[model samples]
Target chain A: MALLEVKDLKVRVEEREILHGLTLTVNEGEIHAIMGPNGSGKSTLSHVIAGKPGYEVTDGQILFKGEDLLEMAPEERAAKGVFLAFQYPVEIPGVTTMNFLRTALNAQRKARGESELMVPDFLKKVREVSKSLNIPQDMLKRGVNVGFSGGEKKRNEVLQMALFEPSLCILDEMDSGLDIDALRIAADGVNALHSPKRAMVVITHYQRLLNYIVPDVVHVMSKGRVVKSGGKELALELEESGYTQFEDAA
Target chain B: MNVAVAKTGSGRAVSDLFASAEGRLPGSPSVIASRREAFETYERLGLPHRRIEEWKYTDLRALVGEVLPLAAAPDAAALKRAADAVKAHAIAGARKLVLVDGVFAADLSDVRALTAEAGFRTLRETLEKDAGLLTTASTDAVIALNAAMATDGVVLSIADGAQLSAPIQIIHIATAASASAFTRSQVVIGKGARATLVESFVAAGAKAYQVNDAVIVTVGDDADVAHIRLMDDAPDAVNVTSHFVTVGANVKLNFFNMTTGAAVSRLQGLITLAGEGSELSANGVNLLQKTEHGDTTLVVDHAVPNCVSREVFRAVIDDRAHSVFQGRIIVRPDAQKTDGKMMTRALLLSDEAEADNKPELEIFADDVSCGHGATSGALDDSLLFYLKARGLPEKQAQALLIQAFVGEAVEQIADDGLREHVIGIAERWLERRS
Candidate 1:
């Protein structure tokens, strides 16, 4: 069975429909990329899967590990190993990064019916992961995402994903606002988290990010649904065609 | 439409009690005269009502219902109850000065632990000979009433250039039910001296009790003083406290007040920059729940040049509770080069909860930089969702955001230990609610 199965999903936000009859599937150990233009509902798909509020799934079924995914709360879905890296990370004042990460990790552990990680052990793991991401230890002491550069915010997202170790990872425009060097660093972090039992769905507007974290399959999404699905070479084909023909087809 | 103001009989009750307790209250010959004058003023003004602009949010006459009988001297049982209350709210590494039933408890308090440069005496003892120190420094009606009815408190004096190693804690415990306690205290810091003073008020099995308290502080030139007040009385207690402070030249004053208890409570601060180059930061937090009404009002005056003052306040209200913050800054014409800023924010946790924030600035000096802001809001839904998405349950997410909301103002504490201590108290408050 596939790790995630979406059957003809239709989502409405504020009484206005955004995702219309979209369906996709992801198996374990496979990396799938969804390429689309602006307002193509790519981010909406990621948010719906993560159980964000205000997005109603009108007619669809989302099955994760053969269980109904829509019925669980956002935090429950997180514990069930569904993670979505936000495109625009929020800055929360007065909440230190270290404190937020610890609370989140322990909460997830508790939801899974497991004992919480000890403080000393948690600190050791955090320090080890943050060092490789080039995030200063002092930054962890500061407020979460406060005074952080765009690159720093993206790197922090990767750090959280690594710590949570989600079974299904959805990266929504993670390459936006990152320079060449930062891009490589973030890609390396994602590559390190890749495992045979874990699946990833990468959604982006351009094919540039695919060069670093290459995917086995790429789907062309437009007008609220996927129009085409092919191998990695299909990304290069669309990059050369500039998505104009795809827009016409939609 | 016309509204008829009802003649409240409760206001007359307060005046009647003062008239009956006049000669019986403790005071010297001169102090007796002052008390008579203060009582006349209280009678003329009556209890402040919603008609008054300053007391619009907190109508003393209406909310107080009826005047509580004056608290009598504590007996052996009452004293034991107060001692137990003191032990529960004690702060670590501080010299304690306990007051039971509004009278200083000698057996419970110890001043010998204080440094040699400090001199301490009871206010009742000092009032026996000299009444000049008990003179009224504020024009507020409730404050004048406190001055007239105050029975016992502490008079602490620190010598010049003395830096006390430990903080001084004045613990006020109430053991009487359906009664009132009035206490007055004063602290005088000499030139270049340093000290930390903490005032905590708690109750032991008291219901519908009333407490009227006052504190007067004078910071000498180049001196540093930090004052912290924690008010956690009985659930149905009514508390009203006033602080009068004067900051001298190049002096540093840090004042923080936290109110987590009481059904009806109000804390008023009247401060003045009496000298140049002085800096003052006054911060407060009010955590209220269930039908409680909490008010924090401040009137800061920058009367000299080259002075700076910052005021930050936060309130977290739940269940039908109401929180009020009124901050006014006045920069005199001669007070040029003054930098004054004030911000007050409130977080409402329930549908029926209410928060009223009023921040006003009156600047007559063009060379000064002064501003004020007030905001009242519920928790940000996006922030809550963000935390929840990270795996925190709904309750834990809301608690985290509420802590961060109040943490902004609590972090203004200059002393590290006091800051952490205040944060710890705030967290426990959240824990209890959740």
Candidate 2:
């Protein structure tokens, strides 16, 4: 069986249908890039898959590892190895990054019936992962995402992704605000986490991000459904032609 | 109800209570006269109601109907209970002065240890010998009532250039089943002196109790002081506390108060920047649940030039609890270059939970800078979703956000140990809510 199977997924937000009868399948160790214009339901798809509030799945079946995904809460889905790197990362004041990271890691661990991680071990892992991302030691002591530059925010997201180590990772507009250096660093972090047992879905507006983190399969989404699917070259063709042809096809 | 009936009932009751205990009250001749004058003032003022601008949100006439009778002295059993209470609330590296059932419990306190190194005197003894402490320029009716009915308290003075190695704690524990306690304390910090003073009002296996407490402090030139008060009385307790502070030139003062366990509480603070280049940072946190009602009223007066004051307060209320914050900043005409800012935020966790925040700024100086802001809100949905998406359960996520909300104010504490101690109290409150 595939790692994730979405059969006729129909989702609505605020009484308006956003994802209309969409179906998709992803095998293990696969990277699926969904490229589309603004308001084409790309971010909505990721949010619904992550069980965000206010998005009602009117009719659908989202199976992850042969279990119903839509039946779980957001935290439950996270514990079951699903993660969504938000398009707009929230800035929570007064909550240090180290505290947030530890709480989240322990919560997921507890849900999986594992003992809580010791402080020393946890700090060691954080120091190692943060060093790779070039996240300064002082930033970890500051409030979560507070006063962070655009690049810092995106890099922090990547750091969380690395720490959580989710099996099914969804990066929503992860490259929107990053410079070339930050984009490369974030892509490196994402690339480092790719494994045979993991699956990823990278959602973006432009094709610039795909240059650093290559995708195996690229899908063109217009309106609320995937209009076309092709190899990685599809991103190149769409980048050259723009989304007009895909809009016309839809 | 008619205004006359409303005013005369409780007013007459208090007047009769004070008249009956006139000679029996402990004090010098001057102290006795001050108590009579204070009771007369209380009679004229009656219980502050909605008509009073300062007591608009907190109507004592409605919330607190009749004051309970004075609490009697604690016996051996009650002393034992207070001792246990002290142990539970003991802060590491602090001298403890425990008050059991309205009177000083020397056996339950660390009086000898504190007296050896610092200036310490029981308030009752000081009142007997000297009545100068009973005088004040301000005419606050509640303070008058405290002065008139105070049973006992502590008088502490730190010498010039003396840096205390640890904190000095004053713990007020009520052991009576259904009684009230009125206590007053005064602390003097001399020039170049530094110290930390902690006060806590908690009940020892009591119900339907009341506490009327007041503290007056004077900070000398170039002195530094940190004062923290934690009020965790019984769930059915009615608590009222007033603090008056005067800061001298180049003085640094940090004051913090947290209320979590009282059913009906009103904490009032009045601070004056009496000298140039003084800095006053005040903050408070209120964690209320069930049907509790908590109010905090603060006034920061920048009476001198080149003074800076910042006030931040946070309230987290759940169930049917209500929280009120009234903060006022006043800059006098000659107080140029004064900087004052006040902010109060409230987080309501339930539909019925209510928060009322009123921030006022009165700037008479053209060159001064002053601002005030108030906000009432629920947990940010986006923030909550972010936490939940990171694998925290709903309860844990909410608790983390609430802690962070109140943590901003608690961070104002300058001392590391005191900050963590307050945070620990906050964490326990959150645990109870969860």
Give the top-scoring candidate (DockQ).
2
The residue pairs in collision within model 2 are none
- The TM-scores of all predictions, comma-separated, are 0.95, 0.95
The weakest ten consecutive residues by lDDT in model 1 chain B span: B1-10
In model 2, the Cα lDDT at residue A122 comes to 93
lDDT of 1 by residue, B286-377 (tens): 99989999999998999999999999999999999999999999999999999999999989999999999988899899899999888888
- Candidate 2 C-alpha lDDT tens digits along B11-45: 55776668766655789888898788887776677
What candidate 2 gets wrong by more than 4 Å, as runs, is B1-3, B6-16, B19-24, B28-30
- lDDT scores in order: 0.88, 0.89
TM-score of predicted structure 2, chain A: 0.98
